[model samples]
Target chain A: EAEVAQSPRYKITEKSQAVAFWCDPISGHATLYWYRQILGQGPELLVQFQDESVVDDSQLPKDRFSAERLKGVDSTLKIQPAELGDSAMYLCASRPTGGLGYTFGSGTRLTVV
Target chain B: GQQVMQIPQYQHVQEGEDFTTYCNSSTTLSNIQWYKQRPGGHPVFLIQLVKSGEVKKQKRLTFQFGEAKKNSSLHITATQTTDVGTYFCAGPISGNQFYFGTGTSLTVIP
Candidate 1:
């Protein structure tokens, strides 16, 4: 019955403003993921966390995007000076040790105008 | 950079009909997973295929992994309105993390 939790289901910000999204993975899950989904496209991985440590972040635009998982339980994704192109759905997901299925949250939709 | 591609970017089908979508990878995939994302919703995991030439079934859904492990397929029979959503195939390249496909959005008209 555990589920991924996300906050601020909808967000609207200006091009130069800063926005932060929060995610809480399934209880006891050790792996967390963040993804960005633009309209009409598949979700793309932004960053990954494994028990407080970063496992992969090669696709993340570190210049204006930052994500952290303090204590490896809950995580946060932040974007400063968001751009118009940054308007997309931010999704958080968690994986069980089995490395099979992933449980995803409802996602946070950020619209930068 | 490894990526997955799915054909028929969009599909329109009538209720009670059959549908299928294919997923291809530029590189060998360690595992292939199928997910469903309702419009304005997050992707939900459906199934995962790991073995080469593997075939698994989940009621109306049948999944097949290519012999080369570079492709996969999902077949759904008697589709219903509840099946209306985008279907995505996601997998990871050898030694790399996961990547999702371009996605195939299916619309079932009642």
Candidate 2:
């Protein structure tokens, strides 16, 4: 089965350092999402992209976090000056046209020391 | 902002027993989706309910959407070791943005 590909399965960074995670969604899936999952907590939406255009990013911490899907396919999420509280799993998901279910990536686990 | 809540933050069930998780939304949802995440794993989509009062089944698992579309439930009959994980309910608040419930973590003991 096709799956979303994510890079840097695990990452450790010092506080105030910059880190980035990459995600390649399944081909032909137009909707992409970036979510943050803290330990013992549900996933929280960070950004949403529809065909290379951002549909929603209200929850994203714009001062420190940024996400982009330039080609409407693969995407990247970046955090500058990472903080300890930023340590968590970053997940990417894609939805096919007219599909109800989402296919999520394995996720990148980030640990800010 | 929309809030989704799930009951029984944690559940420990003996193998072969039944387990249920309930989900509720502060506002009516257009649709509700269920996902399972094993420890140290990403969330995997399980099912989605769109219509009010809809019911769907997948093998031993059953899902129900309330009449008001503001609540849902997931029931696992005869739970097994493989059924251990956290179950989360998610719904779109507006457009493509989705909000997830707090989640219910299940542990099946053999």
Residue B71 of model 2 has an lDDT of: 97
- Model 1 chain B — which ten-residue stretch has the worst lDDT? B91-100
Candidate 2 clash total? 0
Q: CA lDDT of each candidate?
A: 0.92, 0.94
TM-scores of the models, in the order given: 0.97, 0.98
lDDT, candidate 2, A1-113, per-residue tens: 99999999999999999999999999999999999999999999999999999989989999999999998989999999899999999999999878988899999999999
Highest DockQ, which number? 2
Question: Which CAPRI level is candidate 1?
Answer: high
DockQ for model 1? 0.90
The residue-level lDDT of candidate 1 at A14 comes to 98
Q: DockQ for each candidate? A: 0.90, 0.92
lDDT of 1 by residue, A1-113 (tens): 78899999999999989999999999999999999999999889999999899999988999999999999999999999899999999999999776688899999999999
- Candidate of highest lDDT: 2
